[model samples]
Target: MSDSEKKALSGLTLDQLVEFATESGLPAFRGKQLHSWIYAKYARTFDEMTDLSLEVRELLKSKATIQLLKLAHLEVSRDGTRKYLFELPDGKFVESVLMSFDDRPSLSACVSSQVGCAVGCTFCATGFLGFKRNLSPQEIVDQVMSVQRESGQRISNIVYMGQGEPLLNVDNVVHSIRTLMASVGIGARHITVSTSGIIAGIRALSREGLQITLALSLHAPDDATRDVIVPINKKFSVAELIDATHEYYEATGRRITVEYVLLAGVTDSPEQARELAELVRNLHCNVNLIPYNPTRAEDGVVTYARPSLDAQHRFRKIAESTGKTVTIRLERGTDINAACGQLHNSYVAGP
Candidate 1:
């Protein structure tokens, strides 16, 4: 087979690999062995599978390729956070972030689901780039492996919260989740798939029967405000989103996470906090209050700023008073522009 006709082995699940092996005139158990090499061992090339017979390896070399992302650029923050830009084979770029903290299981890998996002949330940097394409399952899985290799640390948590919306590319996201669990050995509870209120995607994920957590980027307390901040809310209203999230919790019995980005004067008001509490009070969820990360405005002005410390404190106080759990996610990787809503493919455009 020609190089252009070769298949990628990095993304396939055990079952899929088994099917491929059988079609290649090999035993089904050979598929499991291949899975161990590609996923568990993070083998970069086909030649690294020393356990397989040389004949079988030679056959695979002709028909298959263990493709991985080409690391284009890497930036490390003084605070120990690292951001990576991967060059896709097609020449598009995607971003991933590795965050370090002082606690056990501290390293978290924030992986992108698409090359660019279509959702177009006004506050996000990726949204401005428009939609390019959905990343393959292997591309999503490779981000975690790449981060692990670069950092030399096991990523305790994986967040589908980087360049694009995970639910927008649900199939690949779900496959990546399964691979992360079955191959990478990360617990389902540690993996999070975040969306900006994609109701259909949320409904579909509930039927997945996986134990991975779901995080809704509910940045606003009301539909009127949310519609402007997260444009997806205009299509799926906050009421509908809340109902769908409730159904997901009922089906999966997992507490969901609601992410609220604190944009200085917009979403960080005490009134907004109270409204947010009332909005999600009935649901089985916790809210992560994230301070906004600076990005270039539509007018080319750098305007969005993190809320003041006092404003954040007041907002948290009001939300906590409503008898719901809330957490203030400390800003990390800000210096390297790797914080929430700040990641942009610099190779394509400037901030």
Candidate 2:
């Protein structure tokens, strides 16, 4: 099929695929077969649907195409974390990280939801690039399928913690989550959608009635520090964000995760930790402490220092003292530039 003529079959829901099949003069069951092949079996082409007859396969080949992401580059770190640069059809690039665990052989895929990012957090690499475009549901789901196929391992956890603010593209993200849960068979609890404090998105997701986890990137405790680091805080203050988080818990009954990125001398002070403890004291939530990832200094771009071990522990101690569950996230994939806040595909392209 010609590139311009063929339709993308990857984004279609099962019911839509059924409509496609029925419209093609085939039995409705062919939709289930096609869905199973594309999502469950990870078929890259129409020919891979061996259960379908040659006639149906040829018909599909003429009208539809199952397109996977074109792998532009793959970086594997010494710590066994892998970063993938996938070239979209429009020549834009997005990155995803595959993290491997030692205790269990499970793998987690951190997928991107946008080309760059509109949330211009001073220290984030993607934020430096600015927003490009929101990925379609197919683009989002393809990240997981690409990681699983390339890594030769099943992804047990899916984190929407990559390039862009997930809630900014809430509809596509939620659609991809449904596909991941219903079609791909990953449990709802295993999927997490992380947003940089989009109150409407959080409230919208809470109404979806799925058991998926909601992680809010609460990088600072007070509005002043947060406004500097997380610019979204300027619009929605810490108190308003917390109120929305509480509403999410009340509606969904799922414990929210408050993610804090520790930056040296900026947000890691003992006093800030106390403020953070007070900020989240009333919310039913867990705190995930992430160390700031360094990036090359560029003009007009803000750089931050990674917190020292003592500072990290001290902050964790203070946050934990508030009787809320808190844990420090072990940094991974930094060597490969795939750790938290390090994904910038513009620099990875060949000269």
Candidate 3:
């Protein structure tokens, strides 16, 4: 167990925390106070609980302690985008990115829930890295706070599209979302969960009545090509994904975001664009077209040729012509590899 987890003798569940506090010569309400401190205050240490009495604080020191993930390294791009690499308790590392624009309205923090990914998207670096264990809710939440601590701006929004397929770690992802939304300042609508089409988990989130936006990583227009790109498409096809997405919108009354990453001469064709327009014909969603970031390949190969500017404009026109609102996502940190599909360098090892 991690030192933090070991020090965290209090409890993991909410009810357990309250019970533990009551046993330490404190009232039941002490549990609520503790929750507010750990979550609302984002305390790094039990000593930071300034509202509690000295004696009560001592009791916590004996039984429990606050735990936080420590910073490992950071990469700052020339364009202001920054990528952070954090070392977990198990020696497995995960990354988070800060995408900031000079004139942008809100900041986006891409948070990872697992050490590596299992989705295996052909165009994504994270997927090529072998799967690792899932992150605890605290570890996931700490990434956002670490970013906040450095920038002094409350993370306006969060995207679970960093290193792992969030649906695989649904419990911790949901737990982190609940704590983040309860941050008193951040609203549920601002925290978005991006997934590689994990249908059951998507449906489950919808039933919870959360207003958090669901961004589906729709990298391909059809199942044939999608299966080659997003391996998860083998299990949950586009039809099934749309079915679940419809349920999500029906339950939450919020539109989902379709994150379409355009790869040159791969899935960005007029035929594909026309097919995609038909795919979301009846759904309530917008498409965000991200360009593929180049990286070295696992076998020392680099076949990924970045798309030309004219090709991108042509693709955008196709998307716009289909009547679905489309926006071409700009690369944030080309120098530091802060763009999407650029988060993994050491592990992916290839383009």
Number of the predicted model whose lDDT against the real structure is largest: 2
Write the residue-wise lDDT of candidate 1 on 1-351 in tens digits: 865468777767789899989999999999999888876777777788898889999999988877667787788899888998887767788899998886655678899999878888877778877899999988898888877766667787899998888998999899899888888888989999999989999999999988889999999988888888888788999899999999999999999999999998888887898889888889999999988877756523236778888888899989988788899997777778674335454455654
Clashes of each: 0, 0, 5
User: What's the true lDDT of residue 73 in model 2?
Assistant: 78
Root-mean-square deviation (CA) per prediction? 2.5, 1.9, 3.4
lDDT for residue 210 in candidate 1, whole number 0-100:
85
Off by over 4 Å in 1: 1-5, 22-27, 53-59, 297-302, 340-343
Off by over 4 Å in 2: 340-343, 346-351
Model 2 — which ten-residue stretch has the worst lDDT?
Answer: 342-351
Kindly give the stretch of ten consecutive residues in candidate 3 with the minimal lDDT sum. 2-11
Candidate 3 wrong stretches, greater than 4 Å? 1-20, 23-65, 298-303, 339-351
Estimate the TM-score for candidate 3: 0.86
Model 3 per-residue lDDT tens digits across residues 145-191:
77765555657878887888888899888888886776524688888
Ranking by TM-score: 2, 1, 3
Over 161-182, each residue of candidate 2 has an lDDT whose tens digit, in order, gives 9989999999999999998887
Q: List the candidate numbers ranked by lDDT, top first.
A: 2, 1, 3
Which of the predicted structures, 1 or 2, would earn the higher lDDT when compared with the native? 2
Work out the TM-score per prediction. 0.90, 0.94, 0.86
